[model samples]
Target: MSYLMMFYSAFFSTSVSASETAATANPMRSQVVADLVEFLIEAGQYLGMKLEQGSMSYQLFALGSIFLVAFASFILAKLILHFKVLRLVSRSNNTWDDCLMEAGVFRRIARIVPGIVVYTTYSLFFEPEDKLYSLLANFSAIYLLFTAWRTLSGSLTAIENIYSRSLLAKKAPITGFIQVTKLLLTLVLIFLLLSLLLGKSPIYLLSGLTAIAAVLLLIFRDTILGFVAGIQIAANRMFNTGDWIAMPKYEVDGEILEIGLNVVKVQNWDKTISTLPTYSLTTDAVKNWRGMTESGGRRIKRSVYLDIHSVSFADAELLEEWEGMKLLNQYLKDKKQELVEDRKLKEIEETDILNCRRLTNLGTFRAYLTSYLKKHEMINQDLTCMVRQLKPTEIGIPLEIYCFSKEKNWVAYEQIQADIFDHVLAILPVFKLRAYQRVSSHNEQAQKNAQ
Candidate 1:
């Protein structure tokens, strides 16, 4: 090409001089993009095609170049990433790169290349003062804005996935923070996109919107409250996904499925879903069993009613009978020693039951229960374990058992509680104690006697 150009220049020096003068004489041609376009038009003239600056053909060529630039740039960017970068990312051992690729971060980033082509090469396709430039620039601005927004969103997701691998994620999850950032970015981008469409400054529109601040506040009241609640919940580590929360007011007794800005979803024990406003968690009282679960124990709080008349001081015969029962042998010995020492110190008459400290059926039963709970394998001995008698009600005296079960799971914990109560109910008669039960009808009396 250089040799041919030299031969042409030597043979047509006069013509070349005349052409150079004509080109240099024109003041309208300054930029390299415009000069290159003019050179293409002149070359088209030699090829039997009419391409002039102010003609319809020039306009058609410019429009055609816009389409070609946009389509080609977009397609080329996609192909490069799809065939090269994406394939490599997919096969790499490093998982973070794969996360970005799957989140569409890299894909959206590739699209920016096309935007750069369309935006920076504006003069190559259209004149600076052309009306088409406004249209093309606006289109590119919107596209770039959307692409940038998507890239940021995808990046946030990738960051979340990366952060989730660490142990601190459960203690203090960054998901709520990430969501707030994403929401703020979305709002900002929306304003910018609208401003580009309407040919107005975003700050101007934002200032004008202040007049309707009250209306917007009313419209987004719940959202604003929810946002505040979400931040507090996350910062304070109030609750998290998979936490067992019981909110009686909402009839929510289940594991949390998700925590969002405006709502929290809980999957109930029956598999139904309950959605509560995020702000409700902050305002309402909720029982979070996460502490119990983390402690590896579940509380067992229950009371058994016993016939009041059946409770009495143990006489000699009763003590002799109870001596054979191994569970009560040590307890009886301990109490006898304690009462004898106390009675001698106070000079109380042993014959008088009121003056002397003697073992009662209720006291013996309470001691037996406390010892039983302490030795039970299913009970958590390291934690609070006690069996105390509560105040007598209209029916009978209430024997309350408060302890912790080793099992934290709902089903297993319930089974442990039931087994303990069932055994206690069955053995009550051994201590001459009867459970309080009211016969609702004659048929109920017969059925109870038969059982």
Candidate 2:
């Protein structure tokens, strides 16, 4: 095969010079020259031309040589993959190489063996001047580019998966960044491949991109915005995977499952997924419940209205009754003594109910609520806990309970709130305070029957 390739190279060199001299000496002989060359070539080939004379036999030998080289390279590559490289890669603890193997990066590199053999043997089958050799070389280059692209892309995806599962990734995720890098790499490779196909320098082709920069930006506006937003989100710690966020503008109220370059996926409380543009998080309002979850308690703010007619100064009988109640015994006794002494010192008439500082049922009920919350096991004592009155309305007086529940979980917190309210409602009558309710037909009918 080597001898045939050498002979063909020598013969083509001499024949090209001879044809050039013949054409220059007699221009009209060019057609006759081509025909004579073809006849001699066909006749010599039929006559069983030998390698010793550098004839068409050498061309057949060269063609056979190329096929043999290709076959040998393929077998060698397969053997290397099976017995040598893949096993070694798979045995290592370093998963990057394993990923490469799984993604066929190694296999793609192995293909280079066959490609090199084919390229080196290409000249054996045909002269450099032949159009087929040039076409084959071009096609091979294109195929090589495609193989490299596939290998790189697959390896990137594998790497991304591995990295996304790592400890560092848990604290600071970079999946979006990695994906963007892969996309840019692909674009660069595509541009290089295009330059090779056009027989132009990559720089020359890239220079034209400057002119279309605006158009490119317009086409990829969303992607650009998302990329920027992703950076901002990461740097600011605005949101992360598994964060509960509520965005009313996009109707997304859920935990963020993924943050991508162009979109953020949220798994709603109902288990439905909502896709939101990445930029929207930066530009619009979103409520992140991470703070609440991290806090010691969950806020509880609620109001209970009291009937105005149910409120009155605590008289001796009522005070004595309240004193018997263990929860408010000390408070009632102290207040009653203080009121009596103040009235006597100020020389105010004891019969005048409004003349001195006196405990009202509504005020006592508010105090009871505050004390109850402070002692409640589910309420966080470390945080502010207050039971106070808001401005009275036409229906009644507004008693607002402001406190924090110790439990932060949704269900537990709700249960605690319900229990607290239940106790408060039940004990309201004990304080001689009635929850405001509209007069109904039942009350009117009972009153008429009694009359």
Best by lDDT: 1
Instruction: Please list the residue runs of candidate 2 whose C-alpha ends up more than 4 Å from where it truly belongs after superposition.
Output: 1-127, 166-171, 333-352, 394-396, 437-451
After the best TM-score superposition of candidate 1, give how far the Cα of residue 62 lies from its true spot, in angstroms. 3.3
- On residues 1-451, what C-alpha lDDT tens digit does candidate 2 reach at each position? 3453354234223234554574679867656645544554565567775452234565455555566777798889989898998789868788787777767777777776766676544543454465555555565566656666777777787787677667756455566686688778678667756765776655577679899999999999999999999898878878878788999888889998888989999999889999989889899999999888888899999999888878988878877777776768677778778978998899998788767788888888877777788779888898889998999998788899999998988889999999988998999878788788779674577689999
RMSD versus native structure for model 1: 9.9
lDDT of 1 at 75: 91
TM-score of each: 0.83, 0.73
Span of ten consecutive residues with least summed lDDT in model 1: 8-17
Clash-forming residue pairs, model 1: none
Candidate closest to the true structure, highest TM-score: 1
Q: Lowest summed lDDT over 10 consecutive residues: which window, candidate 2?
A: 7-16
Indicate the TM-score of model 1: 0.83
Task: Write model 1 residue lDDT over 181-218, tens digit each, in one string.
Answer: 89888877877767667766555677788899999899
Q: Measured by TM-score, how close is model 2 to the native structure?
A: 0.73
